[model samples]
Target: MKKWVLAFIAAMTFSIAAHAAIEVYEFDTLQQEEQFKELGHTLRCPKCQNNTIADSNAELAQDLRHKVYEMTKEGKSKNEIVEYMIDRYGNFVTYNPPFTLATSILWLGPLAVVVLGFGLIVVRSRKNKQVATEEKWDPEKEQRLKALLDEKNDGDKQ
Candidate 1:
């Protein structure tokens, strides 16, 4: 029917409209293309908390991708592009941020935690060992316990 054909056409149009358009960049060399892809994967999207610019669909991510592509075309080295992004977006933009005083805690916190955990475990085990040794039967205490049991047995015999 005519109504069915119109509905089908409308559905198709809407489906196409809902899909996002992909951007295509032209590179003179294969190395440039590889650099672009690598930068895309390396740079984090400021708008998307955990997604790389390559994986994010946010507008900021698109802008960053374009910037990276432009920098690549300009014959900039990968480190230069990364440093530019870091200067613009702070260390949060790069997945591998450099070690500095501000980031020292991030790099050292896990090791500190592991060391502290082992220390606590060692201290706790020593304490447990001490308690076990204290609880072991000494001759004086063993004699007292035997005396008490003998008294109880004697009373029960009555």
Candidate 2:
């Protein structure tokens, strides 16, 4: 059993060593390389909605990465590349989407909810305080309640 475990560990080490090298892309200038990397981090993967293209391993993300590299090589501006992606995949492709009529809800919905939550809390707290302070036990009512309880107890005993 120990021998098998050692062999498995050795196999894993070799496999990891075989694939340890990071991928490097050739660029005419360091600025273009930096731009390509920045775009990869900025662009959201359509297939993996929560992950950027740089982090996602999905096939679509790979294609998008290649496309971004191609566009960068073609001397396309950052805005042009972003606009192309937005045109193809809609605003969901970018983390910072423009504030259009359609996207206003995305920006304002949380604010509305927060305001509503605070208003509700205030109303509830005020109501609770008013109930606590305004409540007064009447002696007559107390006497009547005690009498009713005693009558019920007597009836139960009987």
Candidate 3:
């Protein structure tokens, strides 16, 4: 009975392993296969936070992979497949989205913020320097300050 249980467990493990096998795609030419792989790596999985389609195990990623395979088999150019994905899933589907007016903020916002911060620092620094220069002690003021300190020390001693 124990032998039968072990045998059943082993069979179940093998079945699960077989079921989890990596998906294989066939292409007519090596170029086509390379194109498919390139697209997979360049395309982001819509359902995942930041994983490429080639690295994601999401259902949407699988569907996208199958769609890419179908398109490749149909002799579609890489650009066409990319365009189709963009149209279907928006520019977020591509790791490197094209720069457009709508996406300009995404591409340029950091630089703008850095420039603004640097300008603010420069203005503040200039203001500080002006204040420091304006507050320079005159000789008369320094003499008066020393006299006051001397008088205070004399009174304390007395």
Measured by TM-score, the strongest candidate is 3
After TM-score superposition, the amount by which residue 56's alpha carbon in candidate 2 deviates from its true location, in angstroms, is: 1.2
**How many clashes does the backbone of model 2 have?**
0
Writing each residue's lDDT as its tens digit, candidate 2 over 1-158 gives: 99999999999999998985455678898888999999999999999999999999888998999999999999998999999999999999999999999999999999999999999999999999999989888999899999987775654686
- Superposed model 2: Cα runs more than 4 Å off: 1-23, 127-136, 145-158
lDDT of 1: 0.94
Lowest lDDT sum, 10 consecutive residues, model 3, at 149-158
Provide the RMSD of all predictions against the true structure, rounded to 1 decimal. 4.3, 5.4, 3.4
Q: Can you list the residue pairs that collide in candidate 2?
A: none
Candidate achieving higher lDDT, 1 or 2: 1
Give the total clashing residue pairs for model 3: 0
Q: State in Å the error of residue 26, model 3.
A: 1.7
lDDT of 1 at 13: 94
Using all chains and alpha carbons, the TM-scores for the candidates as numbered come to 0.75, 0.71, 0.81
Model 2: weakest 10-residue lDDT segment is: 149-158
Ranking by lDDT: 3, 1, 2
C-alpha lDDT values of all predictions: 0.94, 0.93, 0.94
